[model samples]
Target: MNDTPITLSRADSSPPRSRSATWLSLGIGALVTLVALYLIVRSVNFELTLLAIRSANLWLVLAALGVQLAAMLFVIRRWQILLRPYPTRYNELTQIYFSAHLLNTILPAKMGTLARILLAAEMENLNVGFVFGSIAIEKVLDSLVMLLLLAVIAPFVPMPEWLRETVTASVLLVLLLLLLLVSVARFRSALLNAVTRFETRLFGAQSTRLALLVRGVIESLMNLTRRRELASVLFWTVCAILAGGLVNQLLFAALDISVPWSATWFVMVVLQIGTRVPALPANLGVFHYVVILALSVYSVNENTALAYAILLHLVVFVLPALIGALCALPISARLFALLTNRTQPTTE
Candidate 1:
């Protein structure tokens, strides 16, 4: 394993967005959350919602929670598969995964991915760009899996025109990304040489490091084309999706609700897409709104749907967050110190 300390560009150390922009985003997200909550309150009978919650089967709820954790494990395994070239231990990846999850819940705009890239690179003494590339590959694969799930359910469910359009756009985007990765991997040597020559002409002495970083990133992307790794990653991705579906199924069972498997899958897909939006910590109101909307299609009562959404959120979001917080505690101080030092301006 390389023991060299990772060097980050100034761009990496600092916030990508300005403070004012971040504040504006937070304000908008808060407004959206409030609006969603207001709509939910207006539509649901709180007393009935509470009664539904109160009467839920505890064992099924516990089972759903357990399945949610299993889903997280599948995600970790998929990431581990991507980092197969690196000297990574499963236990170390578990800590980093959960810690990133903790940050994702609190941070807006999926900043948890950035945190994961930094934490994984720093802890494992790996190249920062390589870690970033692995995450990129992971996301592309996830998008493909989600699209596949949507395709499977399309025949059974009458998707709204808007959803069909969104899926069409997503399919095009994922295809473009996949093509780019394949092209990069196929011509990695030529691309690296070109990058090195360009950087050398522009930056002179500092060119080598930049070239090496690019090489690391290219190598990471190359993993996608490897048949064995691709197959393994796909398997894990499917497993994670299945595990998530089971969690949804268990939650429905807990509420004493009977919905077709396709309905459950639809809800799962909607939740996946919905929670990706910029929102309050842990997705708060946005999550519940999406769940209720998805459940509404099946003629589920507003109160019952609300009850289901709240419980599902607790299991799928809150529980992971709590576990992630615990996992992050040991590394929190070190991570903070590293970021602080990196953010400080270097003196000549």
Candidate 2:
């Protein structure tokens, strides 16, 4: 049984807003990029900075990249496993990694989840439900994993109560949201009934659209239960996040900076926490300011935090373009456009 939900018209959907949004997102991202570069320059002596990468431990660089790549690979596998109830191509997983990262590099977001789903759905002729659900799972698990690590450091890190409270609020908010999803998934029919009734109350017969949405949600939940291949996906996600924590620790170490593990974890969590919020693409001005602020609690000098943020951002950001460009080599590269336009096939 194919569990993916069929999307009828994706091509006509040119980002809901306008061309202006595209331009705005680009401008925001570019501005952020410049600010980050400026910080790197300010952080160290000009001549010394240039020589640092040359003189910096190449092993640390490779280690960081390797850990990140491993995380991406596991993410791909997780997505594929989620699509298990339906037909899928595991080899195609790389395309998702590439395209998602491509959008991140050029657009906002740590990854282009929407683009990733469109690409996979079109290529496999499957629906988007499983993919969408899997992405949700990724977000939840990533947050949980990050929070779990922070929990360990909480007792050790000497930060303001407000910071601790904020993290707690963030974690709890996310947990509540996921709990809601799990609840709806478990009691889908009741939720659907409520949705239908609510629509009837609002739009009467026009509630057809809302009714359909409820149906879709129910179908998504059903698809998820078809198989559980990636129980280990969550397992590996925890490992990957831990590995990332270590990478940050090493980064500080190589720079001759000493931050308690808890402090560094807090910094890592905060840097990513900001990106998750919807903002201009590539997470422009927000990413930098947040990173700098997050690190300040650790008594980390602004210069070092700024420099770390710049390089760290690029490691996850620019690095993908290389891989995305490579993945684009396949014939399947056009998959997303095709999926988007599936409702109205373009005439040659």
Candidate 3:
């Protein structure tokens, strides 16, 4: 009998279907990238785009990079808050965060998230499900902050009809998720009892480990929802979003493009929502397309907008990857080993 806990068992279970699905997703993403690149290439003057990028103010670009780092710090702080009572060391956590950032950049489908959850769990000797739950709460807080920012800016900015509808849909979807999580957290004990009963009745005592894993996840969520933790996480989330907006503004300045702060905020919001779609690693063509779309409303030329998008991707994705490599190469190696089933995670 393999007495490994359910978390490790599930993490190591990579059946043929899963491999096929990952390849299929990558193929689809590549096709999307080619199509988007085609459209962009047809619309923009390549020379002009190169010239715009070349002419960008180097000093402002540096400033934007600095702000981007600050934004990442805010994100790390929010995650720290979610990881209450974990006793995670600041330096170690920072490395893990950026290492995950690097994985997120190169891997398709945000696999970096899983890496972070696993690494954090191992580092803190914590339950894998609990770490997963904390990350879930982090995502929920981000969605709420983005929606709030969109609402505050939409009234002042001239947004496209499609974007407005997307925002509306997003608001409803996030609210629904938030409500569901809250309900689960509120009645976690009862939920656990129900799960155990169902599993026992269906599969006998052998299946109870799954119930225990679910209980860990639910308890983590409940811990995160306590008033003090929620408030601190919310505050850091707002700071992170605002810091991201500032990076956008700085990038705009770098390009010497004069646009309202509202437009910058709107573009940030669009990028956030757009990148959530499964795409080539680091969002590739999708990032440029949405940036161009958002800037079009403000009459920014396609070439210049592409320049901005390229620079933005560098600061947002490439720089972080470099930092992560420098700081967390060993951790990343372990993450890949775990994913490949080269090594199993130790049972908690």
lDDT winner among the candidates?
1
The candidate that wins on TM-score is: 3
Better of 1 and 3 by TM-score: 3
Write out the backbone clash pairs for model 2: 5-127, 10-340, 11-340, 11-341, 107-282, 108-281, 108-282
Q: Which residue pairs in model 3 clash with each other?
A: none
Q: Per-residue alpha-carbon lDDT of model 1 for 1-348, expressed as tens digits?
A: 233434444334334455687687788788888988999999999999999999999999999989899989998888888876667878888898888888778876565666787778767766667777888888888787788888888888878676677677788989999898979956887888898898889879554666757766787787877899989998998899889899889889888998888987898887766666667777889999888988887889899999999999899877888998999899988666554445442322
Q: Tens-digit lDDT track for model 2 on 54-156?
A: 4556677667777777767766766666665565777777876686777766655333666776666567654455455566666776777777767777677
Q: What is the lDDT of residue 342 in candidate 3?
A: 62
Clashes of 3: 0
Off by over 4 Å in 2: 1-54, 108-111, 161-165, 193-230, 278-281, 331-348
Give the Cα RMSD of candidate 1.
Answer: 3.1
Q: Between 1 and 3, whose lDDT is larger? A: 1
Of the two candidates 1 and 2, the one with more favorable lDDT, higher being better, is 1
lDDT of 3 by residue, 1-348 (tens): 112323434343222227777888888888888888888989999899999999999999999899999989988888777766556677777888998888788888677776787777667655667678788888777787788888888778787888878888888989997897879856877888998999899979766556766765775677656799878887888788888888899899889988877987888889878777668988899899989999998899999999999999999999879998887766756776656656553444
Point out the higher-scoring one by TM-score: 1 or 2: 1
Candidate 2 local lDDT, residue 107: 57
